[model samples]
Target: MTPAPFFYSIFGLYLNSNLAIPGLIVLPSVSKVDVQVSFNEFPPALQTNIELKQKIWWVSRYKDENDRPLVTIWQLENGDYWRWEYGDRTEFIIDRKGTQIWANWPNNLTLEDTVTYLLGPIFGFVLRLRGVVCLHASAVAIEDKSIAILGPAGAGKSTTAAAFAQAGFAILSDDIVPILERDNHFLVQPAYPRLRLWPTSVKALYGEEDALPCLTPNWDKRFLDLTQPKYKFQELPLPLGVIYILSDRTTSPSAPFLERIPSNNGLISLISNTYANNLLDKKMRATEFDLLSRVLAKVPLRRVTPHADSENISKLCDVILEDFHKLSNNV
Candidate 1:
């Protein structure tokens, strides 16, 4: 007998897939499915589609031993699907409608490696196609509202969320934050219940690097399990209360500091840190700009500069919670 598909909900969409996403929380059974994931074989339509005018859509910053881009995308002329190639081992074809994904990978390539690509950029691209404005940020629940932690890679977005989780706060999302506009408020859609951290971060948070299990055997990165009793994962969408842009860590402060950023600068930061930004078209950029402009009018954007000392992480979380309290009292 054939095995049943796995069911999960993330970024407010019900996912039904033949391949189980390890860190994502699984649901028993769902009546509605928003996205379907298939691993059988590549669809014929992808090969038959004519090349679009812009055949090459994106290239990863990372490179292979041959010095070529590790990941390259070929945007099909058919406008029906986008093909993503990661290294030489894995490839995924995503439909333009964001409703289906077809994936292929060699057995030599660890399943975790394929899942790393799927759960990160692949799913982020799907959310973009579905008209959700996504940010390269992490979100955590504070009181009744959500706080979005925005930064480039290595800027402590996930680390900050993990720190909050250790303090009993609920993590709304990690890495890619999906934003939805409803009436006058912008809400945050939760991602999976896992936080990927560098070994250094794990050591800082848990007293040792081995405190959490390695995300994959080939990777030194460890992941914090939010499903564990001590941690929390927020499932419901919460209204965004603030956006905190993390600046470079400094040594002088010995503590994290927060300041309100100018609206113009905040908008620029939002555009720069948007998820799957390299693949967005002019129309998508325009929509994102408009939506974020309105969000700035209501939600404040602040800059946070943290101490370089990894041990000061708890102090960082304390500063953010205090800021949230002030924001709440003012309202």
Candidate 2:
């Protein structure tokens, strides 16, 4: 059977994949989809196995310079080779060029589970291979400004962005936010129209915990479906206004607040918030540092601590908007 190609757009690029990607926007044939990939029976494989050093693992169980490994990398004679054992009976093999990914899974495994992991961190790694500076952040467009919300896991980057959505702000991207440099400016490229949220965030936003569909069947995490025509996702690149690194209230003062980060510290924070940054090699790290230097010099950066309860997200949004205007007027 000749499987018709499925076309979608994401991360400011067109994608033509062999399988249907749910929650992705389909475009006409005349539309441009730059990157092409396929999920077929067999893709070209390495002729021979070379030495592979354990780059990263499924879990950081130990730190003895070498130990248990899950996701391993091998510099094949032809190109880069990656192997992932996701433990859900799902596995993946990705080529060096970031153009192809081969998935393997147990027969009983749900398709949702396979696609979830594949698209999340696995595909983020592929984007890293393609040299996109992916950030662990979410963004919203306000007054034509791309305000990126940066934070570590559980820091409410997506949750905060979802609040912006509830407040009638258009979401730009969530989770893996890709940034591109063009014409001497840093631009936050628009991604797909989906925002993943936890049960608590879903309930807080929609008042119905189970209103939206799960990101994957086995996962409790739900996502905002922008395809409904109601939630409009920003579709073009916008020059970044500032990257607000979020801090938990437990570690912050009583009330929500924002603080300016020194340029040097901002550079460090930028590197720390980068998506899949741990996988960067020495050369890649050097390039990343250079990019960060330029970005920090050009774009504004700040740190924000939201109220502990997190119920009144509107207040936090108000503080951010106030500061954004202050910064913008000064600039």
Candidate 3:
């Protein structure tokens, strides 16, 4: 059956797809506890399951969602079928086509993160078959250009990104940003509207008592809802600009510093910062490597080591912005 079209704008990368299954069409709800989702492929099994539940929130589990099995896998005739449930109200089913992803998500929640996670592998398959590339980094667009934050898990990538957002800098993505080659230039898209911060970090940013509302209840991570209208959450895509690689030096008493590095060096540093899940197959790793290499070649990279001081977030933001402005002027 023909499905209704749902439009999603992530960092300016527009995706228009249908949000319907065989007997079910998931629509966005106005409730705050509602779930948003997207799917790449729709399998009959998924349709049947959703039809049975009628309304429930289910996302990928992977120790992220109340320890529930977030991802459901089913073997299909053409390829493997994967479904991601976001809590109890949203879900997405994908058909593992070599190049195309029959993807769709709930309109209520931003599907940026879900899309970015799948885009890497989906695009990787396309690029390897067609010889293209992708990267593992966080990107934001400032002044119509995209700037990426690259680093390891413990690195302050998300923290820095949140600081920038607080300073009125529009956040393009939190953990992942897809770099697509268009018109002989690179275009970055937003990955999600939420930033996952550690509870302690959240306390530092919003204050211990203040950050409580943002906490994910029993979860260890605190989610900052950038989609709040007050933040003026931006959905537009910006051009690619600067790349900052984060490092933690909180144990030291020194102030934060930003070091400019050659493109090759920057690329290597980014490769080291990638967060790879254990379930990712070899093909996924190869694809990640290719994408990281391509991104490094196109953008200027910097290493940003932020001091571990509890009060250094604001200061770190200022220092990074100064460097960004300097680079902007030189460019």
Candidate 4:
């Protein structure tokens, strides 16, 4: 069956996907040429027996006994990816040109589950193949520039960015913020305006656990929709300002503070916080490192430690905004 063409706006690119990506911000129409997405059947064999790493029920990357990454086994030829969720399965065949997604899922699971895995790690790898540097960060537009908040899982990156919107700023993205370098300046590619938050975060912000719609029917996670024009998303890529890596409060409860990360420590922090770093090969890692070196020279790097008391969220945002404007003047 030929699926109806679907359009989505994300990662500063117009996507034409044959399969419905329900999570993305669907576009009614677009005329630009960008990446094409399609769904089709996959090959019948594992590309190679060699295993580089095995992730639980998600993906197992392959490499030979010599520690060399296995080349593609597809007739169309690029590489192969396999994913499983509770025995429901998916296979991806992709190259720098585009991607073809195929899947089989149990009736019990929701389509959101299928699409999440499809777009999450799988599409992240796809972007890397296309030479785009992505980060596991959330970003917000502060006046004229973008500030990306980087941290590990549960570091409150999304919640803090959403707080910026509450403080009269616009959001650039909630997760997987894409950073690009052009014309000798780093730019932040805007993502969908929605912010996915946990139940605890939802209660903390709105005092209501159901303040926002859930991302999936079976999930407790809710979405912070910023569709109103006043607090709407930034549609275009804005010049990068600074990258702040958030840390848990290990200090006494004074106030949230920002500390600059020296140039020597910048690359190590970025490599650790980058999106899809685990999937990169040797050459890709070198390219990513080179790009970060140039980006750090232009964009400031800092470590942000929030106050121990959750009520200090507003104070943290105020200080960060002050610091962001102060640094953006030079960028």
Q: Best by TM-score, which number? A: 1
Tens-place lDDT digits, model 3, residues 1-331: 3333554443233333445322112224222211122354554455554544333223234643466554443334334443344443344454443322445455554444444334444333333333223345666556667788877766777777777777777776666565666775667756556776776777777777357343323345666677665553446556677777777675565578878887657656766655433334567667667666766676778877888786788888788778878878987
2 or 3, greater by lDDT: 2
Worst ten in a row by lDDT for model 4: 70-79
Q: What is each predicted model's overall lDDT from 0 to 1?
A: 0.87, 0.75, 0.57, 0.73
RMSD of 1: 2.4
Per-prediction TM-score:
0.94, 0.87, 0.66, 0.83
Q: Give the winner by lDDT.
A: 1
Candidate 4 matches the true fold with a TM-score of 0.83
- What local lDDT does model 4 show for residue 277? 87
Q: Looking at model 3, which ten-residue stretch has the lowest summed lDDT?
A: 29-38
CA deviation > 4 Å runs, candidate 2: 1-4, 30-33, 46-78, 251-254
Q: Write the per-residue lDDT of candidate 2 for residues 1-331, one digit (tens) a residue.
A: 3434787667766677677776777665536545565543334554343234324433533333344443444444344566665544466777777766776678776656676766678778777877878788998898877999999899889888988887778888888888888988888888778898898888877788898789876679998876666567888888888889998675345558888898767878889999888778776678778888888888889899888776667878988889989989998
Per-structure clash totals for the candidates: 1, 1, 38, 0
Model 1 ranges off by over 4 Å: 1-4, 47-54
